[model samples]
Target: MPPAHSTRPAIAFAVAAFGIGTFSLMDAAMKDLALAIGAYNAVLWRNGLGSLLTGVLFLGTRQRIPMLAVLKLHLWRSFIVALMAVSFFWSLTVLPLAEAIGLSFIAPVIALYLAAVLLGETIGREAIIASIAGLGGVAIILVGKFSGDYSDESLWGAAAVLFSAVVFAYNLILARQQAQQAGPIEIAFFQNLFTAAILALAAPWFFSMDATGEIPMIAAAAGLAIISLLLLSWAYARAEAQVLIPVEYTAFVWAALCGWAFFDEPVTLTTMAGTALIVGGSLVAARAKPKLVEHTEITTA
Candidate 1:
């Protein structure tokens, strides 16, 4: 029989899956906008709009921003998140949709291992085997592309995607800790404010001449990104690592569909193979039960 606390993480995984799906759609919209306005410009506008929305919500809900201590964490978190967004979007422009999505799937596995390292959680036999199997699957899927015209440029893009995954894993660990202490709304508000500030500083360096036609799409993307981040943060705060990590893979299905519908990216056997391994690993991890520990504690960073 499953433990009583297991259900909460299961519920959180479900929510995270939905949020990832929504984010895929949002990425599709942003991709189109980026094509018109450039990736940097799109990011700038989206972050700015998202920050404004967060500001309004904070004011309306009567939530107060914390002292400099909390503000410092928010700033660092925002910088990393912004870097993540830029890198991921830049990769979107180069790699084939399926390849990009496949590589992005590496993050959850990274997070699973990191949980063991940073949070002192155990990586059981099942998870280790699952991780190796998942890596094998990814290698098999990319076997053909090894000799193709995949120049150093594409290689860098792949590296960027991997690096982004690492930062994202770190970001999640921090955000999850923060969420445990504060309400989701408080976390969301500070994240937006911090992201906005960082992007605003970056705007002059990255801004372009195409903002006029791209504002609407940027606005749409901002809304989706904000909502997705909030949902994911809230869900992670309530959930355990083993369960929630697997569900994040649902982003690929969403990415594949969105890539096909918007970017005309085709599905192939490799994608199916990689996706299968990912799902299998997730299922194995989800089913395993780790010994219960003290409840997670959250504090203002």
Candidate 2:
């Protein structure tokens, strides 16, 4: 029989995939919300409310405040999160959700390399197979979606997504580290707090409630994001970055669904085919050898 820790990788991989799906659905809402408001406002309002929501939950957990080191981790990660959100959502304003997500798919690929370098995670055989399947899935989606369109603004948006993708790669590593150090509720709380704080610095200039009509939608967006973070944090705390990261590809499958339901973007055959590859890859990643040790909680002292 496998060791007790051996089962965690599959469970964590499943949880991480579910988290990505939830976040992708949130992205669809944010795209419209961002176009209605500004990207800055949409993201700012989401995080602002997320702070209150997570705060309430954190209090319910009765967890004490994290130490200074954990606080530093939250603050630093938030800076990257804030920037990544702004750029990616702003890109959504220019490109269709599917197209934007396709561009951002580069993140998982970049993150695989970062996982090895920053976190010293091994690029295991399962990880390599999963990545190939995921990238092939993304390539198929992009080919099916793009038509060699030529728009200056769209080109700029693509660039923004690519930049955000790189930052997101690093963000994944930080997430693994942070998850090891904090509970999901605590991570959710401070991440919402510090991310909002970072975005708030430009609030007087860029923020607005002019999109008040969408306040309910914004609140829902905040709820989805927080829930997703909680799930992902829980997963990362139990699994290696290599195991969890492959599941990020599953977001495209959810994104395609979002496009179909919300944006009238028809699901093409290629989408179905690509979605299959992503799911297959995720399963392979989940099948990773659980010989590795699971992450243990780091102490405050």
Candidate 3:
């Protein structure tokens, strides 16, 4: 086997782009599921089915069950992911897919600051400028929404996406930590398991068996999500985060096309303008190098 660093950046970027495309499709399917049944039920079924699929893969691979400490960390991440997924999917149910995706571009910028604060990484001038640009983009989008014939539902949807973006930023930081300790399969499996377990508590009130025909769609969403997560995890483990960050912006393009083709939601000028700024800022931030820290190693017997 080749060294981890031997993985070409081009290959990693390609994988990341493919992952984004799959995830964009998954999001579109999820939006459909949410509209057909309801956001809560959609989330419940998706996670439950995802857990089953990943669980089978986990066992087939003969991976050991995580210890209690690892399980606790997984549980914590699962909770955050659950909140992020629910909020983002709810926003999808109301907002245009491209608009919702454009707003989510704030997450990479937020992750820059989170890494600096939580991981002691140094922020550079480019990152500061990126943050300003990203925030400005968001302001522009919000102003456009307010000036338009926007309803309260749109405002709520925007708020939900923004909230999910914040949580997702933190989740990125946690992902780095988790990646150091476990493989992508383990992370994906436990994530679904824990999310399903948590969401199951609310299933009694919100769950409905009304949309059985949508099972295929829900399963497709879960399958795409799993593939995307695995691909991204593999890419990140092999390459620098900075190198892969720009690939994330490609989701906007995919989302825009998917929204137009599937929902007849035209990409508005506001979305284009805001997305350009956000993507530009993210690229700048990605170019900034984090300060390197030297580590002293100790051997444990």
Candidate 4:
């Protein structure tokens, strides 16, 4: 039987999978709503309502909202998150949602490398091999796009998604560090607050009230947004890089399904091949034995 603490990482992995799937589905739903309404409006409403809900919930819970010192980190992280959202949403407009989402899984690869370089954890041979395989998978997918079904902007879209992935990996590191010093609520609360502030400036020019004549759609987006964030926060606070990274790739599964079902974009052989490599490589990384000891001594008298 595996040690008890071993289960903790496994539990975190489950939570991260939920986070990935829920967020992907939520994003797809938001994109559909945005198309009916408008992108800027969807973004504005989601951010505004999400920030409001977060603030209200935080106040109810009485978490010590991080002071200015921590707020600086919050702002920096929020900036990254804002950029990521813009890039991701824009990419979804140009690229097949599944392909764009597949590329975004590169964030986990970035996170693994960052964990080694920035956090000073040793990069194991398996991780290096997995990274190479994952990159090869991405190349295969991109090469297939040369058949001309995709647009010239698809390349830029892919690049944007990849950049977002990189920035978001750094965000994960910052969130993990903050989680150690404070509760997930504090980190989440300030994240939404600062993200709201950054996004609010953009709203004046971009915001709109036209959303398919559906207030319910806006409310649905808000609910999913909150669910996504809560799951992400809960998972990030608990999981190790290896476990979390693998699970994050599952987001593409949600995207692929959503895209196919809603947009009628047929899944191709190339997608499957690339997805196999990416998922396989991520699994290899996740399956690597965690070096940290899993069991602690009990104070037996």
Candidate with top lDDT is 2
Question: Which should have the higher TM-score, number 3 or number 4?
Answer: 3
Ranking by TM-score: 2, 1, 3, 4
TM-score of 2: 0.95
lDDT tens per residue, model 3, 209-286? 986889899899999999988887776655445445546666776798899899998777776786688678756755
- Predictions in order: lDDT: 0.71, 0.87, 0.77, 0.68
Candidate 2 C-alpha RMSD relative to the actual structure: 2.9
lDDT of 2 by residue, 127-147 (tens): 889889988988888788776
- Residue 47's lDDT within candidate 2 is 92
Whole-structure CA lDDT of model 3: 0.77
The runs of at least 3 residues in candidate 3 whose Cα sits more than 4 Å from the true structure, single-residue gaps closed, are: 1-14, 125-146, 239-247, 273-301
The candidate that wins on TM-score is 2
Please tell me which model should have the higher TM-score, number 2 or number 3: 2
lDDT order of candidates, top first: 2, 3, 1, 4
* Candidate 3 local lDDT, residue 212: 84
| Clash total of candidate 2 | 0
lDDT of 1 by residue, 1-301 (tens): 1122323455566788788887887888777776677667777778778878877877888765565665677778888888888888777777766577678767767887788777676767766766766666666666743446777889998998898888888876676556555556666777777776777776667777668777778788888987887888767766656556666665666777788887788767776777687667656756656543222323333
Q: After superposing candidate 4, which stretches have Cα over 4 Å from the reference?
A: 1-7, 149-152, 212-214, 291-301
lDDT of 3 at 282: 56
